[model samples]
Target: MRGLSVGLAGLAALGWAASALAQDVRPNVLVVLVDDAAFMDFGAYGGEARTPVIDALAARGALFVQHRTTPLCAPSRAMLLTGLDAHQAGVATIPEVIPPEHVGQPGYTLALEPGVMTMASRLQAVGYQTVMAGKWHLGSGPGDLPDAHGFERSFALDASGADNWEQKTYMPFYATAPWFEDGQPASLPDDFYSSEFLVDQLMDYLGETPGADRPFFAYLAFQAIHIPIQVDPAYTDRYVETYAEGWDVLRGQRRDRAAALGFIPEAAPLAPTPDRLRPWASLTADQRDLYTRSMAVNAGMLEAMDHHLGRLVDYLQAAGALENTVILVTSDNGPEPSHPVGEPGFRLWMALHDIEWRTETLGERGTTAFIGPEWAFAAASPFDLFKFYASDGGLRVPLIAAGPGIASGIRIDSPTSVADIAPTVMQLAGAEGAVADFTGRSLAEALSGGAPAVYGADDVIGFEVSGNAALIRGEWKLVRNLDPWGDGRWRLFNIALDPGETTDRSQSDPEMFTEMRAAYALWAADVGVLEMPDGYSVHRQISINALQRQLAQYGLLPGVFALVLLGGLGLGGYWLVRRMRRRRHP
Candidate 1:
């Protein structure tokens, strides 16, 4: 027994030595994930929000103008981390928007399945310390938290979103914030703000192994700019009058700015505004004020997040780790479009929770604020639509990478997918063996000024979530978005010429369109893409899911109320029958 113990100690010491050697040669990686930020929502990308830190990051690194992700958050996250399609990563759709018919069917399980490896896991296997802080809407099942997925330390929120100031659910989809630290339930601090707390937690984790030569992979997923877009009044004050021109004018302004910034073609026609949006001049004065305040709040929330990010960067620089760290900043998807205040039963739910929706306190604590679809369209700018669809407006977002071995002040316009992120990180970390196992190709060469682009013109990539689908082949894109915003028919566009998707080339280029459709069909089958049910609408599905979750959370009280109402109705009918019979006899 003594001999065995000695052998174990010797092995442990050798393992430590290997890890130390690996750390000495490799650089640290920091991934900053913003929630529901649009393609042009950063100051570097010509957005109204003042994001100086991110803008600086862009100035010093490669900015990808044609990068796209899955149209929803969880799926984009899964793909971003795994280098796989959303289905392959085991999160085809989020719980809030998934239909009942699709539950528990293979990739629709909504959790990372067995044998799937995240970037954290891959990096950890190579002796890198992995830590994560912020929203982790991945899964809550056993072995599904960040700890099980190779994060050495994690403070994760396992819900779509929650109040920024308190430990409460943002919508009826969840009962609580559902925060966890290292897989154990946790609570927020007394003076909690989402962005500040998330950064603080990450800094704490990074400090745990201070001066230790072990390379670290830090994932900071901010909940900023998502629904319930709350920020300090100080930040909100900066944008109060910025969006007063309203969405229509804002949309045109953004499109023009995008062209000026070289993000799109100079003559790219603007996509038509969504029909559901009312003309800004036609709205009541009160309505305009409310909406303007809400947009201001959204911008403020993003700026606040950027401010906190600057803090983390400063911390790393002060710790002498910034010089060797590779930083990647991006959003999960396009801007959020849902307005909980207008959703059925949401007002009552807010009332029960003492939440306010007044314009006077739009971005303050205890108030729920959102930009809704009109602002979402403007935020997306030169693109066709926003989140929950396959439109570029939903999928195309900002991606900036700066660090060792990356080119400075370069913009790569070659189409790139979120799945490419994991492989790129792996290559940068010198973990090349695992890159082959992933479906995504590495962009390390492009970032390092070696290659012009990552994907060749002939390469095909596909995306699908909740029935919305798109196929990208070189410069041409074939997309089919579900109803309410789209006709469910496939349309072809030369995205290189019209990034705004202003013209449909399906009729003009029949042969290419048919070929791309066939390619998409093959890709979908290869990726285990499930067919959505007839007339499947993401909005309707969300409503259905919310009702189901609400019933599950507070079923007993509602059930009792329903029974009492039925009982009272039965009694009233009996009384009426007796009175009528008595009158007839008399």
Candidate 2:
């Protein structure tokens, strides 16, 4: 027994030495991505959600207060992995939102171009074991799966989002969940929840070939708090009365909290409530009840996701890999604004498919729910609009990075975009040379010792989605928010001083606005941004895209059958008329 114990101790020491050596070479990268979470949804960012795991991570890492992602998911995900502008990455906008005229345009291909290398590919080139789980909306089909892009093992959902608890597509744009495992069609385990299932799959991948001496890059994307915001009943119960006061009050509360936390200037002006949103006081009791429950479900989803994230962190700690791993937590975009469950097309489709949105099942297995524009507006807090617009609310999101070399308990106020993530991760993995030439700057300097700025005063950064556009040069930002959100007017603001974008300095600073506009035009031309058709509306474009898909899938078959049936009826009628005429003549 004594001899066996001595042998075990020697083996343990050898294992420790191996792990230490691996840490010295390259830190393991753990990217925790959440879908459609608002800027202040997590407790770490000052919202009411209980996210102890994420908060703890913020405490140990740099919290980027002004970080921005594209206003939607796919484009942001593309930028995050490729370290390039969304247009340069070939996903200028989501497929469902792309107009037919713009479908095959240079930057509107709706998928990452084949030659574009991903962060995973860059890291894997340098001996890292790259693995990914959860959402992979960059592309679809066998050739587009994560394995093809450099992940050695991947369990990916190639759609925007799907049902959290069931293996089914949540939106009509997808016919199925489109889940895949290492480039092959895969099935979900019987017991599944997006957050838990993603973490478990990543852990499984990490455990395979355990003795191999290689660092890892794990991208764990969660479909939490997206549409169909379901969570365990226990989690939902905790926030039952949390949002009883409604979005109006919640918006003010969150705005104040953000100012207090220095996320916004102390005197930052609140953006006016969008004209489309109905006043909370005008809602019926049932409407208020349903909306309130939906908000609770949203919060519950975040808390549940955080809890599962903690489980993964705990596992890493148990394996003695936590200290050597760099973990980043962020959202793909801002709060979702579309209320699909209430759309005319959605209701018709649900009726045809025999699905219903029962209040009792609001956040349960078979029902769908969302926070609507009102709550989404509040969720974005002091920012101007929700998802699908270029307002700070839609683009600015939380970015937390913690691990071996990152500075602790600090807030990095420098402007950072999702495009910077790939280069930053490559730097941390010590695979800088492996990465392709990209536009984003590395955040290494800012992460360790504070850098005054990541971009030079003359360097221009531009963003565009659907039709909304914004360009930032030094302290000035020139923006255009299309229809419903704005009057389709060009505006300007010194974002450095007025982050909420309440005051437009266009009239007051014509010279700066003119310069910024020219810069945006130049950037657009360089990136091959296509012109939006006149009267292009994102909401209308989505409906048209859905119609196109339906026609492509089912319209042709039914239309052909109808034509054949009508032809037969016409022939019979002609024969009857001829026979009747002959009888009359005889």
Candidate 3:
């Protein structure tokens, strides 16, 4: 007995040393990504949205007060998955992202380098299953897709933005061409809302995927509440009668309610809704009813999503995987404004920050949307601009992490970036040789209620709206306007107290302003996003010893069906594209 105890201690110490040296091991990681949502939409973050499911998560885990994602989806996603800044990966702008052909060569465009250890590969190496469902906007091609990079099982749409749920619709602006499901395209019509469809597919995959008995990495990127704005009849009914007055009335009410509920700061004034919208009283009765109904639908979807999330939690809890799984919930970018409420066009202008995005028309865009800035503004609190704006209002998002080893209900102020999620999950998983070329840090210490500061970032963050630039460092943030009729100049704010960014302190602090500007430029050139599929490689294979298998099998190889499923997807994709094109043009 004494000899056995000594041997076990030695083996444990050796394992610890090996893990320390291996550097990329972690627990079963689950990243729940919300689309185009700002930091304060949920009940946990003190917003009006009935996110009881997420609120439960917040109550059970640590919430990040100062968390941020890049302003757009593709670059932000790249940052998260690759653990590098947009500059380092070279995918700065959504449209400006370098093509796959332009990637991976020495001294060329930034793309997901094939050699780097992705979260999937790292987890796979340690015998964990890697599965991704929902949006895979980074790329759509063979190399660019999740399976090519490292994910063992995937069910995702490769396009960047879509609010429509009806499948197989064409999205030309997404850079990936059209989004698809499985190997074939889903025929999402004008009314086929993405939020509902995404949930359906995700639920299907979770219940049936491989390594269900093994430690797994589940990356669920939901398409809820993005564009082609949708509201199921159930949720739409709740607000059809209530929100007849348009955004001003709704914003006023939400602000009052939020402030009263202690969700908002006391002294901060409610930023008025934009001039582009019609007053509720002015719109016709049908228009008013549509607005209210639309809101109801949106809210209903939120509730439905919450219910489904509860289902997932119930599954984990029932399986006893609840204690072992570390769940992370966050958003892709800020709340995006799309279509006309009662208004005629997309209201991309800012209320106060003056960081207005150029007005665009969905007439040229692919889908239809009913609601406008009213719904988005109602969702985004304390922030100034819509999704594409570079300000904190456009970039800030809530990050909730809960599970065993996590301190519950704690608020962390460390400068955590979305890019940190991959490395953080790797650290949590205890997988060895997980990630390299990572520009982010693990929040493990902080999540566990320790205050070890996140390193490397010297208090600087960058954002871009087309060519417009915004930079945040310390308490101050700078926004450069791109509106030609205006100054096209820099405006700065102290974000700590002025979270809404109502006041500009740039004129007051010239030296500080200069420092921020220099920092912004330097960081922009120094860091970037890596577009995946550019020779990106995450070569992790599981060790039977690392898994908690249901059977006594020492080495569990993936079934042939799994191989055929992933292997045939790319070729099948090309065939589908050909078929669609033939049908369309011929």
Candidate 4:
């Protein structure tokens, strides 16, 4: 009896200590980010972009087709890091001015604001070794740098975004332009892809993982598929020939697939934006060749990256941490608005972008602008409009969660958002999700097939980029220009029914529009939407001046060429295998 008592007492004591320790131990989290791709682009979601590794994972995990996020790159990454919407972060617009003030308010800026909690800081507080490798678009100055925040080790762009995705970056945000590693002035080959370097470092880091017993939190943001897109020439031939169809044929095909998948009620009739194209017939074969190569380079980069993702998973499985570690793969945003900038990639292009009415594609002479609506509509998938707009097609992203507790091959219809990612991640790690509560809920139940729903009916979601805004409340969504110039431009859509915001019901149901607008006002007050500057904030000459200085610094001749170059695609990240990228049929 005495021995039994001692044994029981010891076991009970150990249990108590473990319970306390578990609270202090944060799970090793791996948040994988895919740049610029959409949910429909994946095999899991039912579209045709090939990502086998991600698909295999999804076959045994949960996929959120309705996951919403900002359609632009920097803002989306910022939102993902902080779990706060854009306004609170003070990153409403992609600044033509990389103001020094926007750097970390402390060392960890939650959208350039104080008191905001980052996933890194939150995980770090509970004993996580937060590490960020690749795109850290939140802010990158003194305290705002990844190191200043919770990330103990950091390898990312120098500022809110990167300069060049290829071996070089023209932007100051990089350690010193032309790409540097971990803030060190390192020299890389001109052809060395930033993504390859990022993945090499990530694998090197994962390669160092001693065991499943010691957990890590890794944020792998790969800046691929973003503009100046480049890839290993080995796979160049495959895509170069594929993209030769030019703009019109490609857009038509994308529409057909989107409709077949039921993402769109019916693919809206193809409406090419005039003054926006080089009419396929008008362009000589040589012109077509160059244009086609520009896009092929971008697509090939995605394909190559997808293959690398397969290898990364192979490494994980070989290391014996495959099933235990949690993996969530998603994109920062969907396809960018194919709107032409003056140049293929430059800052001056952005100033021209604010012109509001001049929708020109890049490659023109003085008037040369962006690629415009034709390509934007094709790539955005089942929705109208691309980056910077408050539309479903613009915000809806692909989300996949696989590992221990999550079920495979599931399509979760719940309207989740990027904010939900952190909580879902924390919950599945089997750790106490007790700290730094957020606007998101644990989707573990849904991922595991134990629960039918994820969040609640009242779970509201909002996204903003450069003043364009959108808010989701249940089935109805309101995408309006908020308060002041607040035309309420009231666009109401049953997102559940029309994931594509093509059919406008504002006129059909004025009452619903008003209700949604009112609801937005109330919600904005709660979340605190930043007050917009009254009157027309865009000044072409002044905007051009600010942009001019930025261009000169980057070695570009100012004006339209800069805009086109800057029109690069939505930036992507590195978080998971290839399967999470596929889109679905309706």
Candidate 5:
């Protein structure tokens, strides 16, 4: 009887200690991820997008000046959530860009590898409620939804992107929009609009909580400013004349603002416009009108997303959970430059489906459009290139972290990766021990200005996506942009002094360049980065994948029939030509 009484007393004391610790720590975590936005698209970052909600967060938190992510969606999100390199997380590149030859390879699986720990799972193990809503592009197979990745409640879309106004796919890679609710296939409501519907679902999730004792991690990823840019008329009305000056002037203006705000050095030269980008003065009036309206819709979509975000902020405040919550806002990658409406195959597909794509209805429900490369270049002001390449513009993006412990109104200029987000969140939640698979360190101390540094000057970070490559160590960076946009020659630059990569110093400093090249070779081999075949490009790869899908659907009969019909037509044409020549000679 005496031993039983002592054991009961000991158990009671431990329970009390655990409860007390929970009460003393653990703030709710809210991560807001937007899609396909450039570094300066947010108002706080010096662009025309009216993101009041994000600007306020920047004012109240720390903005990371040199934050980088992969050049595309799946890889960036994989790193952000797992704190592992894109290859380490098993999403080396998006499924659209993965070559057929490398489809099932270790790093090209396009799914989270077994044993990879996600931030949600880590937090859930530590008594935090995990919830997610909006884009979840990681995977869509069994055991691949948000529930499998540690989210207890989720309403997610498992595609690169979807239509903002309906449950339809925005790209050719997917046949339908793959949406899942709590691990089961679900459908979107009839009244769907990307930003509004996402918040509505997330708010419903947050409101279902029983009490304030248990902290929650809510991840809201908006498909705003992505493909088929749709928004209310009011938001678009504000930017009708905003882009009239065109990309050339807008690029210079944004560069000046970045310098004034100390986002870039004043002496750093702006990158010369690429030869592919046509000047505004060379455009016809009709072309100018079409491009301007496209940009207007793009800006409007961004503001519409912010408007919906403000509603969520209001709800959290009304629930008395705003002040204690940690809010981190960032984009998956830089601006999207693909123009599907201009493609012959895409136009033919629309025609076959009886879909109408008109200029006046560009931002409407049935129409699909994109800003293409010219606007994407301007969106990434002062930087060299846009998304889908390994340039600074493609990798560089804005990151703002605001919460209970972080300093307000400050900018951290240190180099950080998207992978750092997971460890940083775990550190803030006091759930570090639950995570044992992180390849990134916490940036909490660095953001707070209380620690020395997270990365050493000698540490090398190598990045690759679809064979585009870059390696950075301290202030030096080595890059190789494949054929179309570059000469495929390795170039070195002092990025700290020239964020625009205006000068290549590989010829001037041979020894350092050699060392960095050797380091990149080792890193690539370790990460399972495979070589791209000769004459490969992401655009051509996408076409190949699309054609493959069509062939699989129709089988071998259609191809054979078409080939025979073409051969007969060729023979008939040759006979007709020969007869005409004989008659002329006679």
Candidate 6:
């Protein structure tokens, strides 16, 4: 008996030694997150953007056709980093659209709560050098920046978005573009462009620890294609005529291309264009030119982002780190539909800030532009609607994974969520023990071709933010979107057969709808999802919040003016009353 025990102990020690050695050679991780890119926005995904770098990655990596994320930015970001639901990570929704009743609530805190462990923190615990660059909208309160959330060296913008060409607020919601490096306020250079600066900062961080034996977990969150989209004219000039055909024709082209690529069924019906948008032919020539120029700029911004990303890839190759690095590229949500130019009082604000919206310089510095809803709908071809809704078009986006241990030239059609990203990264980095702490399952097997799918047919997943809700169970999806885009009712669709969500199966498949609806109710209760107040609209709430923030920032002068105007009126009224009384007495 004593001899047998001694042999078992010896085997256990050998296993531990083997694990330690394997951990020492774990692959470096590079997670690239783009803001508000649609499912078909990248060239590899059948869009007009000249994204050679990202396309090359897709060519040699796995591209996910059914990946879903929250419809909003901050919530999706929270899920991507923590491998948990948006609520579990303490960012139920973005501050810009958060309702007043839900503020400061348990899940709606808009910041990472205590005890939440991020991917960077977990990787750093196991000897990985973690760094980050670009947008960090997770939080802005005390200890809410990237440095406090496991990033070692970070140049993070702690807002929804800011000017791409300078350190200024893009919208009236912010007083300034709050940027920080290593937890201290950082300033930008005179020639700063967002995409270039973000990549430059990441390279500097990587170069600081040259030839280090330890691996790295670098997160590059680009603000490309977000609001105030700006890029060099050199990139924009190539696409000046690409969108002249307008959004309706572009929508059909994308849908056909998506079918050819096997992203959807050949017979899948395209979602009807919303009644709110005018037909392309009805628009005046000037309007068409402006819209066309805006889309060209959108493509240019994406291409510029790709060009800069290639620089980082080149740097990694030169340093011999590319061979053993795992690169995952994805977007936070679908394309943005908001057009600030059309909003009331927006022109005045633009003029006040020296922002121009001319066609000739659409994507240059000092210009603010967006693709708006029509183009956003076109960009999200073969699917319904765009961002800020729970429809597939808003939640479904592209995900590409490449590098060591990941199979090349693979396309994964299985349904996956952004929450699954952190666990997969941890698993690849040899931090498997920490994977159990997250709600998201690892996609390591799927990426390695060990399994065709991650979740079984019985598995259920639920997502909600600012009243936009969706639940998935196998081939069925239950979605409820409120206000502007949706009628505030639950609709069921078989996503496997209809990725476009053109047909509602609630009445046709009653049993499945009932079962899924009940399952969603249970999941929502378990997750502590708060019901939105009656008559709530995210768009309305955003305007309210923006106005409140603007008032708080620059209200004193306006307040004084209003007070002075009221005082003069009061004095005039009193004098008139006194004169009327004297006349009556006389």
Predicted structure 4, TM vs. truth? 0.76
Candidate order (TM-score)? 1, 6, 2, 5, 4, 3
TM match of model 5 to true structure:
0.90
How does candidate 5 score on lDDT?
0.80
Separately for all candidates shown, the number of backbone clashes (residues 3 or more apart, or on different chains) is: 0, 0, 52, 67, 0, 0
TM-score, per-candidate, Cα-based: 0.91, 0.90, 0.73, 0.76, 0.90, 0.91
Q: lDDT (0-100) at residue 149 of candidate 2?
A: 89
Superposition-based RMSD of candidate 4 using all C-alpha atoms, in angstroms: 11.9
Instruction: Give the per-residue lDDT of model 6 (tens digit) for 225-328.
Output: 89988898888888879999999999999999999999999999999998877678988898899888889989999999998899788767755668788999
Q: State the C-alpha lDDT per candidate.
A: 0.85, 0.81, 0.59, 0.57, 0.80, 0.85
lDDT of 4 by residue, 93-193 (tens): 45442223432322223345667667777776765556667776665445666666677666666543343333333332232343335544355444345
lDDT, candidate 4, residue 110? 38
lDDT by residue for model 2 (1-586), tens: 3223323333343343246445556788999899999899989989888999999999999899878888889888889989999898888988788878888677787778868889888887888888999999887644777888889999999988888878987776666788999999999876777887787777677766652478888899999988878887688778878898899999999999999998878987898886667778988888888888889899999998998898778767766778888999999989987777655446545665445565567777767778878899999987888887888889889999999889999888878888888999988888887767887889888888668578888987788888788887777888888866766788999887788898999899988888888899999988778878888766556655655555565678754442332221255633443344334320
The regions of model 2 sitting more than 4 angstroms off are: 1-24, 352-354, 555-586
Candidate 5 local lDDT, 225-279, one digit each (tens): 7887888767777887998878788889989999998988899999999876789
Cα displacement (angstroms), candidate 2, residue 417, comes to 1.0
lDDT of 3 at 104: 44
lDDT of 5 at 69: 88
- Give per-residue CA lDDT, model 3, range 1-586, as digits (tens): 3323323333333332233224432355678888876676766776545788889998989888778887778767777776766555545544323333434443233345445456777777777767776777665445766777678767667766544534532221222225555544545435344444454444445444345445667777877656544544555455445555566665666556656655456676655555644456676765555556555555555665666566566556544456667999998887766442222111221121112211122211233443455567765666666666666656888899998678988878766788788878877777436456577777788889986466444567666534456776766778864432113567888766676767777788888888887887776556542223433211101111112121222223433232222122354633453344334320
Q: What is the lDDT of residue 522 in candidate 6?
A: 91
> RMSD, model 1, all Cα superposed?
9.1
